[model samples]
Target: MTRFLHDQFAKDYLEELLTPYGTIQSSRPVSSEVREVDLWFSPHPESTLSPDSLGLLARAIQTPAIFEPFRNPATTREIRDCLLKLLEIDAELRRESNRQVSLAPDTSPPHLWILTPTASRTLLGGFGATLDLESWPRGVYFLPPQLRTIIVAIHQLPRTPETLWLRVLGRGRVQTQAIEELEALSPDNPWRANALILLNRLKAHLERNLNPDWEDRQLIMRLSPLFDQQLEAAQLSGLQQGLQQGLQQGLQQGLQQGLQQGLQQGETLVIENLLRFRFGEVDEELAQIIQAILRLPASEFTPLLMQLSREELIERFREE
Candidate 1:
């Protein structure tokens, strides 16, 4: 169950970060064996966000690519399964191109990225994976050229901003350290907001399990402060906006009435922000429940916002 949770997080994290630069298809189906590729990404010619901003992760996705992230160290069999998926995709692409005008003589096969927390030297050696450190970074190993596959040993990656995105997919100490780095990035950093939101979602999922392991408990503790900081920030924003609006009304009405109005609006705005962060958007169904949601204290309502599904939340808070 925990493994599936991590897999979902990886897919969500990668899709969020890469969406601006390319087309991202999660759980892409392969024609044979009903195997699914974890992620299939093809870069856009005129992307809104610069690929350079993502550093090494951007480099990996410059071409058509497949991403397979493992929560634990990948065994040999797992690695082969990833390869087979890639080959299946390549064949599928080839057959489709046959029906269209050939653009560049042939379609290039997508590069396969196998990401794992750790990879032993023997494990790499057994697959004949070699490091081209002169061309790439320390932790990345490539199989033979024809294979077009790269195995990233996350634990071996240098602790730097360039590797931060990929490192977030790692486990244990590697993941903990990566998140710490992620938290410290400037608020203006484009990736920071979405990454934190996804991490918070992951935290909520992990917490739902009654018996999380020690590492997950520590992770939950670390993530709690970040959530608080975001909530506080949201409240501050709401208050400022409310006060600005209230002051305009104060000129026509009593100062006390305006201040009371400001407080109410402020709380409402805060709840709206929380809902948006949790569920992407607030539709008419959710809008109907904002007043009901605002009636509860932050401590009481915040968990409901985190743990409940869209339908569940609406059903729980829908106006009578």
Candidate 2:
């Protein structure tokens, strides 16, 4: 199966966000082999990798590479191999750094994280076991709880223009204080306004194409303004179609009812003519029977005519 485009989009999105924090790598071949990693993040040389960074890495690593239907196995295998190599490298790094060099006990190991969107129960089970899980360095860990929680929250939000805006702002560990700083700016803060506009556009693209089914309340509340226009357009289109269909059906039914009534009247006149010719005069009894005959549909009139002879019709129409 071809890998799902959403999976690729998610990977790209996370990579872009995480790049500033650390070195981000994707689909790199492990060693000289055909195997490749989905994503890999290493700490910046100047900064000591914190638990938060490991948390972010974990989120990236755990993000699922959704399988694309009809995708080439070679592609999948290559991706799997790259991920395995990344893990191997992480293990090797830990072994070398922790064992060979005497680093401080408090210093964390270099982390390696993976991303999978729809991880199967079997794959998760495998990770729980020794094949892939054992390669991590001691201090280096996957995405920490906080980062995972944030990612999960973002994932749950509805894929709408508004939700996407909130997501960009909500991602990672930006300070609440910084947000307050932005809020404190006057209406003329061109820089902040421009940033908001760009962010909103990015969110619109993500919502429109990537996660179109997201529906989290938190995300919805934050981004409501951007999505209202699209939502209204869709609703109006649907309403117009419904009204048109309803009007057509009503017109058809009204025409059918009028045609049926006209047919009944014409049939009554035909039955009166047949009675007057056969009996020489129209009587009260014959008139009632003719009325009934006129009301009878054409299909019923044929069967009644087949069963009745001239003599029987005259006798039945004779006054008591």
In lDDT terms, how accurate is model 2?
0.40
Put down candidate 2 lDDT per residue, 76-190, tens digits, no spaces.
3543543456456545557757675664332233233332222333443443322223553222223333221111223233333323322333322221223334444454633
- Structure candidate 1, residue pairs in collision: none
Best by lDDT: 1
Best by TM-score: 1
Query: RMSD of each candidate?
Result: 2.7, 27.6
TM-score of each: 0.90, 0.31
Q: Rate the local accuracy (lDDT) of all candidates.
A: 0.84, 0.40
Give candidate 1's whole-model lDDT.
Answer: 0.84
Which portions of model 1 show Cα errors greater than 4 Å? 48-52, 103-108, 276-288, 306-320
